[model samples]
Target: MGQICPSTASPLCVGHRHLRHSLLSHGRSKAPTEFPDLSFLPPEMAISILSHLSATELCLAGCVNEYWQELADSELLWKGLCYSDWGNIDSFLPDGMVPIQSYKRLYLLMDDGSSLFNGDSVSGLEFLLNNGVVGPSDRHIGCFLHESRRLHADKVLRLLQDRRGVLDELVGLLDFHDVFLPDALRKFFTEVPAPKVRGDFLEHLLTKFSRRYFECNRDMGLPQDTTYVLCYSLIMLSVDLGSPHVKNKMTKREFIRNLRGAVQGTPGDYLVNLYDNIYLHGHVAKKSHYKVYNNADF
Candidate 1:
């Protein structure tokens, strides 16, 4: 019986057959299962990943979702427009550009107007005045200049000139002349063409602007007389632009009249004489206060 058991250890024995079956079953159990399905992540996490894309990329991605379309079109997202340099706003256009030209025109007009206001010298004023020889169509920009000490009155005329050189009184003048005039005077003034009067007036004003008449005047060896020039210039401007209502609105008349009164007391004898000739006589001394005016306003 022991001899029979020994023989079963050979390759063809039933014990050997059982061992083969066990090995086969163990190998099948160890085989790798298919990889776990990983496609069901949260939608919020996916959106968070996509939020940091650039403007163009965001634009394209917007086609994929309503929220993205709105975010992409936001003005805050337009870094190109927001960070644009003085005249460089034109460079941000895409290949099929049409709106770019509109943006450029607006920006250039605004820049030209602003330069005259913030500029520290006659150079900027002259440049802006020259540009104004052509019209600036942006009404908001024009209105902005109206409120700021940005440009000399002459420069404002130049801009009107450039706008097709239309001679218009109401276009440039900021007041109602009739209100300030007697009825007879108002009738005479109304008979004149506004454009012709404005054109003629502009020419005369330019001569004063050319002479730098309203500049500080202090450095022309007459520092003590400088303030008079400024005071007179301010009053003259107020008179030219102000209506009778404005003059009537003068709680500040004492201040203005006092300065006008002191015009005679200024240290420079020649300058005092000059102010009388110009302010009262409507004539001006031919002197350039470009540097002086620039310093005061700037």
Candidate 2:
């Protein structure tokens, strides 16, 4: 008669008990093992090491095992990201969240709620600070207008009267890393106090986007017209921020002069060159090929 080993089908024939320990040892060695001695590190050390990973990478780390999962979702780790990325979270704390708040949900709110697909259309001031506004698209133009109607008088006036409204500037949408959008927008939006007039908003945008462009994308070889597209859009939007003067229609010549003025006023040397190149090197109205954009294009 023989008995089976607990983990194996091999029979322990009569008087073969001495072989059992060796068999058990061999079977146990086959179990999976994680990285050696990781758990030995103190929690603070662990948090410091793991904090360098981006949010996406942190999520992958959490799947390794339960202990690693806890470390990945550690409040200390996300707190660092929240402060580092979005600045002090105290300002964003909602009313109901009394003693504490979920940094993860707050992160999602900033990240997800900013996208065109996910967020509600908030006021220009709030939207700029939150990084929740998207640049205009065919469908988005109407949506932006709709949002304008929903707000209070101050916010609505700020939107329409500010020269750097959704129409006037793309804000940080083009130049910044989307992850840093919330913080970047907040810092820059706060740099200048609420602007009472439209031109001030345009000036802020020209200054800000130009500086950011020079800093980040200066070396990038953007096409002449592509560069012109940005210049034209900003210039046109600024000049046409409010209702176009019905008394005297905005003519093509007036628009071009406005472009020149905006280009001259912008801070970057390269931006000035791009504007010059577009106006001089290429015939903007070559052979009467100038395409007219109606109000809808704006």
Q: What is the C-alpha lDDT of each candidate?
A: 0.36, 0.44
Candidate 2 global CA lDDT score? 0.44
Return the lDDT, model 2, position 141: 33
Scored by TM-score, the top model is 2
Model 1, stretches more than 4 Å misplaced?
1-109, 116-149, 152-178, 181-298
Error of 1 at 10 (Å): 85
Q: Please, what is the TM-score per model?
A: 0.21, 0.34
Clashing residue pairs for model 1: 117-150, 132-159, 133-162, 134-162, 135-162, 135-163, 167-195
The 10-residue segment with the lowest total lDDT in model 1? 289-298
What is the C-alpha lDDT profile of model 1 across 1-298, one tens digit per residue? 4555364364335444544455565567584344211112223333444446543465576685566564445444343432333223232222233543333344345456456444432444344445442223333233333333334444443444453222232224233232211221122122211122324443333333223322323234423244335434543443443435444432334434545555554544443443343344331221122211211110
